[model samples]
Target: MTAITEALRRLPKVELHCHVEGTMRPSTVVELASKNEIELPTSDPTQLYRYTSLDTFLEIFWLVQSVLGDGDDWARLAYESAVDGAEHGLVYRESFFTPARHLDAGQDLGDIVAGLAEGCVAAEEATGVRIMLIADIDRAYGPGPGLEMVQRLVELRRANAPGTDRVLGIGLDSTELGVDPTDFAPAFELAGRSGLRRTSHQGEVTPPTTIRAGVDVLGCERIDHGLSLLDDPELTQRFVDERIPLTVCPNSNIRIANAYPRLELHPYARMRELGLLATLNTDDPALTDLDLTYEYRSVMDAFGYTWDDMVTIALDGVEGSWLDPTDAGALRARITADADQLASSLATG
Candidate 1:
């Protein structure tokens, strides 16, 4: 690898917008499908991820959800996800999972949470990669299901369930076109009362006004796929002023054809330039066939970002994370030290 690519690979990464189910290895998906006698469209793992549009991709995404038969499957996925992320310089991750989908598939919520929690623990022990879960309510299912999911999470916490504490917050994701953020207000409020952090996927394919509602109505602390915020100068300015972090997945954006059709046209660098707390991520690393290191390198190459700029982005991720004050501070210090060393090496060469 070149010096720049090597340095980018060594930088500590904090990924805030990833899905646990989306992290399933293609091979594992096929293996699990065979073991469970689940019929797949194609037995070849490589053919499973082929998609022409967001709706088509969701078809495969939903299909993979069915292959997970029990808690052990979720645990294995969690462990493998952490190990894969660690290989790409991941230090901390706050991943999302669609509980309603699993519940609809005849899987118990407790088993899902416990298995993922167990896997996260094993991952931390094996790779030192800290993992947290965000239970995402599917927007298409409407607010009733969202409220029920929140209650389930509350019950799990009250019971002191094994993986319950690992769940840090709740999120809104999936098919944002027709769903209004305000529709989920009651659910978000319930989560708030139960002490869960809030975030939403807004402005990916929707208009800028959705972002405003996400903040004003849903009380979202951060936004995912907010590339469309630039359409509204006033709202964009407010986000910049408030330091609302936007987790922009460039590769995912290109794949979904939402914001920018080309990498060079991506708004990630512009968001940074305009002082938005923008962080890079691999939205669905396994599905997209990309990782955090590749994300950093690709963005740098496309935007002509230097190592210093990479450090700034890395620091933004640390600041934007939901980590507690003490832990965030320590992670920031560690990232700073690493950046300093990388800077020194680059200067010498």
Candidate 2:
């Protein structure tokens, strides 16, 4: 492989929009289901993740979350999930976990947290990848349960303490079609009060107006699937000016059949051209059947990205992450050094 391509292979990335349930390895999912005596909707692992429609995909997604029935399930799920991310050249991964989904399945919140914490520790040790949890509150369930979910999430995070150094942020997910960002102001405010980093899925299925509502009303520091944010030129200009990082999942969006079919038609390249902070991610790796390196390469192969363009986007991920300044600086330097090495090789060639 060329030096640039090799750099892309070993180049580390920070994942900001990964879903814990959707990211489970199909093999691991079956093992967990078998161990817990939970029946899967699809016994075959390959057929389990062949999702096309957004609605059906969500149905299957919730079904798998159901198989993770107890706290130990959460621990094993969390731990095993991170290893997959690490193996894919990801140095840092913040997984979105919805405890309410598990607890509503009759699993206790404490147990779920305990299991996830165990998995986080094991995964970190196994792969040398740092992992963090982003507590996700499903909007379709309404704000009352969301309020309780956040409270329990905070308690869960505090309970694990130093062992699970990975619990870091809160995210708003689930269908955004009916739920307005303003509906859960109280929950977000509570998250802010608790000092958790905040992000939300805003415009994946909604118009650019919904993105405005999220930035103005909900006060999210970063946005997941904020593709529609490009619709408004002035607003897009502001996004570029502010450098608000957007975690763009082109394959995931296309898999949902929500966006254009081709990668060039996606907002990722436009976001980059406008100088907006855009980072690539596998929102659901198993569902999309790809990793960070593969996603980066596909984006390049489809969009014809140059070495500098790709490296700059990698740097943007480090700048856009919730990592402490020191960590961010370290990752940034690694990208820079890799880029320089690739350039030197190109010059020699």
Candidate 3:
């Protein structure tokens, strides 16, 4: 209902599992591409994000990264993106940042995180939006580099400048093909030892077993793209029982089309019916030509979710994210109060 749309606007949101570079607006991409002296495939930002398959989408995603050539580019995008996120009512966000995915093919990992952290700091100052980074490894690269990336992220978090939430966790991103998350169990063991939280992408383009492997093996506190969990009722029931959060990305799922395809086909409703912990997000906002609002709105429009259901789902994100408990509680309280007041106001009218 239109009331739900207006109500959703009033309720602040917490984003978990968004891709860093994927948050870069197309206009930002164009500007960065020009400064880096790179030729882009399209002048329009919207069209650039219109890729239909995972393969083509990644090609465009990597090409955008190529246009962002240095630490400054990285910082600029991250900071401004924080501003964009804030304008979209984001109080806190957990970003899955993959430094190696765009590491200039031979750059040091330290340099990558350095620029990103600085940008996160600057973004916080500029917008008051708390941004946390999750250093992610491309699973497509096999277990070797994935472990290396996780180790470096742990070191970076340990070596933080203090007073900020710098790096919060480790994530397994990129295309999960023949790569089963269980294969990298040792890497997660190392990440866990360093006090970094963990999560991974699975069951999006694959099967339900991948979701099980991600949970049972990689030791993920939360599961990303767990759309396949529905295929296995046992897993769905377990997820609902265990209350493990699933970060659902409606627009990105539709864009990738390799996963859940259309927004109507997205399983947020069914997951909700089962009482599973389902959190909505835009996996790649820029690549999907979406923001958190668009993703939530699209899901609401397609699934006919009410404002109350949407608010409840938003709260699920706080529980499932890597945010500190105190912060999570505060955010949940605030959003819950706001939602209640908004609904009450409408009811009275």
Candidate 4:
């Protein structure tokens, strides 16, 4: 590996847009498929992830999610996801887990949360890379189920169920088109009332109006994607003024949504230039054959971002995170000090 690439990989990162289910290793998918008795379209795991568009990708994503038959399966997925990320310099993440299909399949939410929490704890012990959960609502399931999921999550928190403490927030993701962001207000409102932080996927392919609704109506503290926020300069300025974070997964947009013709065409640089807290992330790392290392390196390569610029991006990630002020300050200090030491060593060699 190039020296710069290796250095970038060593830089600490905080990921907010990642889906734990999307991080399942290909081999794990095959094994879980077998264990769960779920038939696969292809026996070869390599061919299992091909997709032509976002809709097609969601089909493959759902198939991957279906492999988790029980808490054990969820634990395995969660364990591997965090460990894999830690290898590539992910220090902390607010990872999303959408259990809509599992819920529809009659799996208890408590079991899923407990399993993920168990896996996270094990992974943390192994790597010292912490991961917290965000119980995401799948937009395809509609607002009723979305509200229901939040209600159940509140119950879990009140009951102090396993892993409930690790669950930091609620988010909305999956199938953004043809879905009204306002329709899920009840769900977000309940999450807010229950003291859960909120975020949502918006403006990936939708307009900036929806992005505005995500914040103003649903009270989202962060906006996932928000790719089209620049389309409305007024709203874009508002996000900048308010310092709202946009967890932009540039490669995922290219690989999954085909939003940009190439990485160079992504608006991440512009987002940064506009002073938006657009943090870098890998939405589905394993599925896209990506790691945080490559995510940072590729952005640096594509946008000609210098080491200092990349450091700024990393710091912005901490700012965008839901970490409490004290934790955030500590992490910011850590990143700054580590980056300084790494830069000094790199300059010598």
Off by over 4 Å in 1: none
RMSD of each: 1.2, 2.2, 2.3, 0.7
Positional deviation of residue 35's Cα in model 3 after best superposition, in angstroms: 2.5
Q: How does each model score on TM-score?
A: 0.97, 0.92, 0.92, 0.99
| Cα TM-score of candidate 3 | 0.92
What lDDT tens digits, residue by residue, belong to model 1 across residues 30-132?
A: 9999988999999988988988777777777888878888899999999999999999889999999887777766787889999999999999999999999
The top-ranked prediction according to TM-score is 4
Backbone clashes in model 3, listed as residue pairs: none
Q: Record all residue pairs in model 2 with backbone atoms less than 3 Å apart, i.e. clashing.
A: 71-111, 75-115, 75-116, 79-119
> Lowest-lDDT window of 10 residues in candidate 1?
253-262
> What's the CA error at residue 1 for candidate 4, in Å?
0.4
- Predictions in order: lDDT: 0.89, 0.79, 0.79, 0.94
Candidate 4 residue 247 C-alpha distance from true site, Å:
0.4
- Order the numbered candidates by TM-score, best leading: 4, 1, 2, 3
Q: Give residue 213's error in model 2 in angstroms.
A: 1.7
Write the residue-wise lDDT of candidate 4 on 67-175 in tens digits: 9999999999999999999888889999999999999999999999999999999999999999999999999999999999999999999999999999999999999
Each model's backbone clash number:
0, 4, 0, 0
